[model samples]
Target: MTSSGFEALLEAVRGPASVNVLVITGAGISLASGIPTFRGTDPGAVWSNEVMEKGTHAFFQRAPHESWKMYLQRFELARAAKPNAAHRALVAWEAWQEAQGRGFAVVTQNVDSLHEDAGSRQLVKVHGSLRLARCSAQGCELGAPRGTVPMASVDFSAFHASPSPETVPRCPRCDSRLRPHVLWFDENYTEHDTYEIERTLILARQSRVIVFVGTSFSVGVTELVYRRGRKLDARMFSIDPSNASLDRGIEPVTARAEEALPELVRVLQS
Candidate 1:
C-alpha cells in the first residue's frame, strides 16, 4: 500500500471555519475487506459472469435458492472481514470534526457495514445493507433484521437440490419468502434511501472540502458524489491505484486507502 492522494488533499482542505465531509465509494475501500474486485483484471470471482451481469433480479427469477446461497456466501465473507485502518481513520476524523463544531459525513457505496463496525458517526449506505431481510409477499410492510447468524444457519445445499427449484425463505412474521434487503441491479432505489442521500448531498455541498476515499468514481450513484462535490466548488481528492474513467476537474490521488488514511490521520492529529 502506498500513500493516498486523498490524504494530501485532506491536508489542503482542513481549515478553521468550513465543515469537512467525506464521501467514500466502493472497491477502493473494500480492498482490505477481502472482497473480490469486479471491474479490474481479476479473473477468479466466485460467481459466474451471468450472475454478475444479472445480479439478484435475474438469479431470483431463475433459482431463488441459488440466489440466496450466493448472497449468503458473499454475506458470510463480508461478516468475517473486519474494519481496516482506513475505516478507523474515517471514524476518528468524524469524531474530531464533531468535537470541533464541524460536520463529517461518510457516504459509502458498499453494502457491507464496515464503517458502522468502525464506529463511524455519520454514514449513508447507498447500496443498502446485506445484514437485513425483507418479506417477499406482496404488500408486506414489515422487515426482519436477519444478521450474520440467521444467514449462516440457512441450509444452502438442501435448498439447491433440484432443477427448476426455488427456495423460498420463511419470513419470521408472515411465513413468506424472505427477500434479501439489498437494492438489486434493475430495481429503482427506494424513495427513503434517495431522500437520505439527497440530504447528505446538501450537507456535503455546504462543506468547504469533500474527499473521495478508496473509490474510482466509475459507477452512476458513486460517481455522482464526485460530480456534485465538484459542482459545489469543494476541493476534491480521490484515492485509488488506478484513475480509469475519472471525470475532468477532480484531482486523482493514485494510492491505496489503507496506507493513505492512517498517514492522513497522523498528519491531522499532529
Candidate 2:
C-alpha cells in the first residue's frame, strides 16, 4: 500500500472511538502460505469455471469422486501450509482488543483452519473448514439437526487431481458418503450450521469498524456485510493487492496481506 494510503487508513482507525471490529478474509490472506486463490486470470488459481462448476451439490450427487478430486488437492495444500505473518498479525490485534475490553471478531471465507491455529477466537468461518467432513444425506442424524462437524475421515494423503470411485470419502456415520464440510458454489450460507451467517451479519451490523482483508466483495457474505456497514457508517478498510474498485466506500490499503498486516499490528500496538 502507498504510505499515504496506509497512513490515512491507520489514522481513520486510530482517530475513531470505534468500539467493535469485524475482519473479513478470503483466499488472498492464505496466498503467502502457498494456498492459491479461487479465481481471476492468475495462472496458479485453484479453480477454473469447470472446477468451480464441479463444486455444486448436484455435481457431487452425480459424481462424488470428481467433486472430491477437486477439493482433495486443495485440502492437501492447506494441510501442509503454515500460517504466515498476516495470520499472526491478526492474532496480535485480537490480543490487543481483548486487553482493551473491546469487541473483536473475524468472519473468514477461507476453508483453511489457519486462523483457528493462529489462535483467533470469536471467529466465524463462513465457509466451513476443509479439515472437516459431513454426511452427504442431508439431515443425517449423526450430529442431529445442526449436523455436527466431524474430522475428515477419508484418507486423502494419497489424493491427486484425479480420484477414482474407490477413493470417494465415506462418512463415519451411517456408512454414507462424506462430503467436504465447505459451502459449495451452489449453496447459500444459511444451508449449514457451521457458517453462522446470521450471527456474522449481526456482528457486522454492530461493528464500529469493518476490515475487509484479502477479499474483494465477490460473494454474498461480503455483500451483506457491505450493505450493513453502509447503513451503520462503519469505518471500513479494504486490504488487498488487486486494484479492486474504490466505489464501495471502504478506505483502501492496496497491498498483499503478508506485506501489510505486520505493519498494521505495529501501528496499532504503538
Candidate 3:
C-alpha cells in the first residue's frame, strides 16, 4: 500500500516531469539511526530551556570549557551514528530525479552528516555540521583567520576543558578557543559562510513541490521555505508520526520517515 505521503509525492511528481522538489529535514529523520529528536517529547531530546541558554555564542564565550565539553559530545554521538533507511531513500530519490532530468535538493537542519554518508547530492546542511571544527580567532592554519579542521584529522584525546580555558582547544596564532562548526542558538544563519541560506531560499523559490520530513517547523529556515514554497504554490507535505498540524495547503502525512520515505520512493519508482 502506498502511503498518503508518497501519494502526495507521486501526485506532485508524475513520470518524466521536470518538477523541482525540495526536501527539508530535521532531527526526527536521524532518530532511526540512534539519534533523538530535538523538539519531540522524547526523554533523550537534546534541547531544553537550560540547553537553549548554553547553546548560544555568549555562553561559549562565558564558559568555553563547559560548552566544548557538551557540544563535542554531541559531535562524537553524531560521528558514531550511521545513516538509516530514510537517508538512503532520499539519496535514491535524488538519483532518480537526476536520471529524469528533474531538479532536486535536500536541505537538512541536522548537525549530523548522515545525508552525506548516504550519498545524497545537492545536499545542504543549514545548521552546520559536526564533522568540522574551526578556530574562533584570526590567522589560523585551517582558514586564513578561522581555519577549519575535519574531526577525523583531530585527536584531542585528552580533551579537557575543566580547570582552565587554556587547556581547551585553542587557536595556534591567536590562542583563542576553537569551537564546533554548529550553528548556535543566538546566531543568524547568515553569520557563518558555512550555512547556505541563500541557496536554500533559491531552491524553495524554484520548487514545485516541497516535502518536510520529521521537522518541527519552528526554525527560521523552515519558515523561509514555507513562505517561499507558498509563493510558488508548491505542493507541500509533512511526514511525521506525530502528524503535526500545518497551514497553507501543506498536507500532514502521519508516519515515521524511515518507514515512509523508502516506501515513497518505491512507489515513485513503480
Best by lDDT: 3
Please rank every candidate by lDDT, starting with the best.
3, 2, 1
- Residue pairs that clash (backbone atoms under 3 angstroms), model 3: 139-145, 142-147, 143-147
Please say which candidate is ahead in TM-score: 1 or 2: 2
Range of the 10 consecutive residues with the lowest summed lDDT in candidate 3? 138-147
Q: Candidate 2, overall lDDT?
A: 0.81
Candidate 3 lands at a TM-score of 0.92
- Residue-wise C-alpha lDDT for candidate 3, range 85-107, written one tens digit per residue: 99999999998888888999999
Residue 204 of model 1 has an lDDT of 67
The C-alpha lDDT values of all candidates are 0.66, 0.81, 0.82
Candidate 3 stretches with Cα past 4 Å from truth are 2-5, 138-147, 161-163
Q: 2 or 3: which has the higher lDDT?
A: 3
Collision count of model 1 = 0
lDDT of 2 by residue, 148-201 (tens): 545644565444443766666566667677777888889888878678999999
Candidate 1, residue 162: CA error in Å?
7.8
Q: How would you encode candidate 1's per-residue C-alpha lDDT over 1-270 as one tens digit per residue?
A: 234455457656576656566666675687677876555444534334565655666667766666776677778888898999889988887877887788788877777878899998788876677776666655555442222124444444645565224446566656666666676776645533432567656666777777777654555565566667767777776777676666676677777778777777777777
TM accuracy, model 2 = 0.91
